[model samples]
Target: MKFFNEESDFFGLTKLKERFYSSDHDGLSEADREYINRIKGQNPFGIISMFIGGVSFAFGPIYVAFPIITIIFCFLTCGTFDREKEDNPWTFIIGFCLALIGLFMYLRGVVHELIV
Candidate 1:
């Protein structure tokens, strides 16, 4: 069975593999190369998705797909967190919080519909 299509591996595993192996190391020693490779920047796409998803959640149940997309983006960008610290950590923090709020809002809306 085809569990994942081609893009799945490309967007997820391939990008992660490239990040791990593609460190600039010319005059630097092995240790320096390793150190540099260990650090990574946050994925801009993930940040954007979280922000947009959070905003979309405010629109109500009709736009439920937005929060789900945000969750997917969160998983896809999970690799970025492996580094020491992300750039502009507050963006991700705020985005993440908003995403959670969005998710809760979506859920609450769903439950309200089911109960009423």
Candidate 2:
């Protein structure tokens, strides 16, 4: 199994092969490969988050409609962290923190509007 660096624009299989065999490469074992495959098979929370966010933005003020969309976005963002923790702990932490921040901001904005 070969891992392609998606960051690069060049999509040649030769380049991918070279990267796979490069000295800087630290290859994964079969177990690691299986784990990655499992992660890929699992639900992607980022997709859910963006979908909810888009709905919320399109439908107008959250205060006017049911808060279900906002709630779903929060849940999905948190789920993203949970899903990422096994393989990428740092990403899990960062994503979780950012999600929390977004939730807080939304709540604060709602409260501020009500108070004013």
Candidate 3:
């Protein structure tokens, strides 16, 4: 049976197939597809890591949690940048800077006990 039509419903598979094969597909190379999948796979892990890192940093020792969380955030920001480089680099830079700032503040607080 014909799959392409205005109202032909093959459990939405036809629509999905249409979207998958549309002109948008032309913009995606094999490497891009692989990278997209890799980023997608890493997203959940990164989110969990970020959450855990934040909790540890907020509640645990600054010396231990600050570096660990900073590293996690750095990795997450790198992954995010890789996924959206074509769209904007500023976001990645901002995220990286924030992570660094957080790390620095934590270190300063632990060392000098100065609120400033």
Measured by TM-score, the strongest candidate is 1
The runs of at least 3 residues in candidate 1 whose Cα sits more than 4 Å from the true structure, single-residue gaps closed, are 1-9, 12-42, 82-85, 88-90, 110-116
Total clashes for model 3: 0
Model 3 lDDT-worst window of ten: 1-10
In model 3, how large is the Cα lDDT of residue 70? Answer: 55
Write down the TM-score of every candidate. Answer: 0.47, 0.31, 0.32
Query: Which residue pairs overlap in candidate 3's backbone?
Result: none
Ranking by TM-score: 1, 3, 2
Supply the global lDDT for candidate 2. Answer: 0.41
User: Cα RMSD (Å) between model 3 and the true structure?
Assistant: 14.6
TM-score winner between 1 and 2, please give it: 1
Which lDDT values do the candidates have, in the order given? 0.57, 0.41, 0.45
lDDT of 3 by residue, 3-112 (tens): 22322342443354345434454678899876764442223323444555554445333555554565554453343322432343444344444445556656666532
Q: How much does candidate 2 score in TM-score?
A: 0.31
Estimate the Cα RMSD of every predicted model relative to the unseen true structure.
7.7, 12.2, 14.6
